[model samples]
Target: MSSADQSHPSGNKPLGKRARQKIERPRAILAAALDEFMLKGFWAARVEDIAAKVGITKGTVYFYFDTKEKLFAETIRSFSPNLASESEPIDKNRPVREQLTTYLAVLYEAVAINPDAKRVFHLLISEGRHFPELLDQYFAEFLAPALDRITSLITSGIERGELKSTGLASSPEVLIGPAIVANLWGIVFADRHPRDIDAILTTSLDLFFRGLLE
Candidate 1:
């Protein structure tokens, strides 16, 4: 093993028996594609540019992803967390409100810190009007899972009498509504009037729980 590869963060030492570069090439391609797609909207992004970014040929890019649209979709999907798995930290043993606060804190931290993923979300909102397929995939992969988890939490809270009987009981969007607004806030004011994300999230959840809690 080379000295540089010995201390890799992933904890995997160099293996002389296998060609890991072959496995890394697709990841490199996707990384390159994300940069290109974010810089030049999906429609304007070319497979040639993505391939060129990674020093690969356009045909090689197509070998991994059949088309530019699929590449764009996969690039965005790659950055999104699996909300189902993310929500696994929820503790049924704890107070429901406390469980919810911890959940939102983790979720908001993830959304606020990942600027590249936020940009991809902006791409989804802007381009989704024209590309229904991307919209469908995004909803199925990210949105539905998040909503389902939120619904489960809210349902539990209602059953335990920790929360009021309201729309948040049926539609948990009320809980995450600020996250959507915060994404827009970052998109517009991130350069000029950036707010402390932690402060914003704390205050939003504080207010959210106060209004919902019985």
Candidate 2:
């Protein structure tokens, strides 16, 4: 049967002929590929496997993405939020405590909602040496800018006299590094309720603030 004959599990009707034959084909392939990669890991996942999962031919998969790496890159790219780009414009006039609280809250919520993405991220960080391009794309697109934002926030806080001058400009790592590690730990190991995430974030902010406060 053609991909059009396949019924979606969502109880929705099948896509129209044009959509199924055109738009839905690539999208469905990507969705299935994401599931496969998340479950199987990037290196282990195969194009044929994704094609099989999507009920499409391997040629169809190749039509959309040239290789497994391209598919994985697209999958990771799809998961990115507008928050990263928007974060730079955050109001520096806000009180440092309030700013930190908002920052931590946003980070916590982002990770909590996308647990699979967090898992994939952890895996990539741990085993990404095998795929240097994947590592480069992941860091250049996501991690480095994120670190820059945190460093900027800390610098602003110090300028406002809200935080002690630890000379974060020269050692940006010292201010936000622990929180990055903490966030990864929370993503990988913590099983706290979603509602309780705020409390946990608040506690982390408190500890961070105590150390940084003037």
Worst 10 residues of 2 by lDDT: 192-201
lDDT per residue as tens, model 2, 138-205: 67776666667777777777788887876654565454454455557665567662234455556766
TM-score of each: 0.82, 0.71
For model 1, residues 7-35, the per-residue Cα lDDT tens digits are 33466756342355556778898888778
Estimate every model's Cα lDDT from 0 to 1: 0.75, 0.67
Best by lDDT: 1
- What are the runs in model 1 whose C-alpha is more than 4 Å off? 1-18, 87-90
Off by over 4 Å in 2: 1-16, 88-92, 111-113, 167-200
Superposed by TM-score, candidate 2 places the C-alpha of residue 42 at a distance from the truth, in angstroms, of 2.8
